[model samples]
Target: MLGTAGKGVGGAVVWFTGLSGAGKSTLAEALLPRLKAAGKKVELLDGDIVRTHLSKGLGYSREDRDLNVARIAFVSHLLARNGVFVLVAAISPFREARDRARATIGDFVEVHVAPPLDECIKRDVKGLYERALAGQIPQFTGVNDPYEEPLAAEVTLDTSALTVAQATSRILIKLRELGYLEESELARAEAPGNAASAP
Candidate 1:
């Protein structure tokens, strides 16, 4: 049920975790179309989008963050069991909450999108890193608050070392190895015409 060749009875959840500006959401967005092209029913649950809608009242406290992660995991579990591949791009900083999500969603793949802290700061388009460093924003994940790196992620992509396409291709290969995708679909995705094939 979990890993059939095509249009399986059950679907998997690919969870992306990282600090702000670390490219978790970007990577998830990049992979969305490829999954759809493979004929899988896929849904993307982005952290900012989820916070604004699903967990609107939640604050940035540790308890609140864990609750938000739980809510995402709950929805992802429901979708995955119903044969929808769920891509969750959340800066779920706490390893404990992430592990809990992994347990809740049995067919889960944890992807740690970690670039260096300095690199993440450099990529901050919203200038959140600057504000946080200036003590304007409290409880920021990488600055004021702690971000517990994944102890054993199924896939780890450092945006500084790998291009977006290369990182995405690696994720595709992992998904194929895990049986959520077929060999033919993988071939098509990595073909010369596909962006994921770019060097």
Candidate 2:
């Protein structure tokens, strides 16, 4: 279990939940280099990548989805226990499943990448929304299935309204508030010209 304080910043799992096109992956991708540049050991367990490896056999049924999430949570727990920050960007539509993950992780930060269903559909990066609506896909979350919004997430990002940089800025603020990022490191990540960082 990852304690509040440890030999280092103590590890954490920052879990991002949202609809398909909710910018969860985009935000996670944007923040990863920032975290790494701050000299932190961080890993991103992206949903699509998880599906390819950890959840290859899992189907779209609620039971299967929960299992998939549980697998990711378990991996995150193990990694976090070893002092590795795990950033998970999964749809993770069920509240119960997400709560279970929170209970299992030592230090968990929940960030909801919120964009309305219509807004998500409008983005449609993979044409998933169009396909799902056309009945090409079954058991799609937020289409025929449900998305249980988080009531107590540490932070909520309106992905539709804010630029990725702005949303990432808010996330850095929250991590600083939770003691994950030192003030100086947070300030550097917050700065605009820091992408010149080598690592």
Candidate 3:
């Protein structure tokens, strides 16, 4: 947590890994403005959006998956080194890929957002689980392919069990615990009537 810091001295990657509909993107979107409001230079990189721009035409094969992850890691690394806090919300199913990312982007916090598969099926917001279960989609993580759970993620949240506010609060707590966030910033964030106010 202390070696290669973000941009000037506070850059870090809050890497969120999980199933497609497990709240990674939603959480990243929610976390960014909070960090920024606390005076942190943060950026959110959603997986699907990255696929369209940073990793166009990448297939679903293992090699392609690795490539996509590496590409995301590369961008996050650059930003982190330059003092930008990168909040990445990617399914990044492979542990090795996550390891590569951790190595590339120092001062990283890995948060695993995993709801039970059955719950995911029930909440299949995009019909992804149903399609994958019915053999309509190939190489779907958690349905057809694999999701290597993080053995030691800095934070793990089950969306089914925790509200968005609760989950985000947990992450903030960890950032403070890791010395990534200052107590004053956290107090400002938690204080009454200042949730959406700018820094």
Candidate 4:
């Protein structure tokens, strides 16, 4: 129940959901190094990365989005079941899809990264907001399309109020609190001979 007990292999699936350019990927990137430093086995399955691999050729239609989320969720569940902690940074616009992922994955934590719409547009890393506004792209997640907010999430980061580092720290703290990192394991990892050991 706490970290990896015996050779059973404990894993966590963290779902970071937010609008594009809302710092979901940014926070996940920041969190990765911290977790690695702490000797945690971690992997990030970002939306853009998944799109290139698992969700190729998927369009912006609602049905396509559903399929995309489903594919990502399946792969994520497989990874988690094998004892690799996974971080997913995707818009994942529908609550139904997210719930399906949770149902499939045994240990899942949903983290909502909520940034103001204006701020997301201003930060538009891919220029998607501009294209959506200009009618160049339709059915964008937060533009013409819908984003169903999670009714219950393990954690919610207000990116508008927190720096990326702060957000990452908050997530790590939550993971520790949730027994993703057992106290005994963390203590052992910090021991002199074990400090350099990898998870």
Instruction: Look at candidate 4 and tell me the lDDT of residue 181.
Output: 70
Error of 2 at 83 (Å): 1.7
- Look at candidate 2 and tell me the lDDT of residue 177: 88
Minimum summed lDDT over a 10-residue window in model 3 is located at 190-199
Q: Per-residue CA lDDT of candidate 4, range 77-132, in tens? A: 77777777789999999999888888777688899999899989988777999999
User: What TM-score would every model get versus the actual structure?
Assistant: 0.93, 0.92, 0.92, 0.86
Between candidates 1 and 2, the one scoring higher on TM-score is 1
After TM-score superposition, what is the CA distance of residue 112 in candidate 3 from its true location, in Å?
A: 0.4
Candidate 2: residue 136 Cα off by (Å):
2.3
**Clash pairs for candidate 2:** none
Alpha-carbon deviation at 65 in model 2, angstroms:
0.5
For each candidate, what is the lDDT? 0.88, 0.85, 0.84, 0.78
- lDDT tens digits, residue span 1-199, model 3: 2247643375889999998878888888878877877787888888999999999999999999999999988888778877788999999999998998888777889999988878768877789888898999999999899999999999999998887777887888898888888898777555555343221
Candidate 2, residue 122: how far the Cα is off, in Å:
1.1
Q: What C-alpha RMSD separates each model from the true structure?
A: 2.9, 3.1, 3.3, 5.3
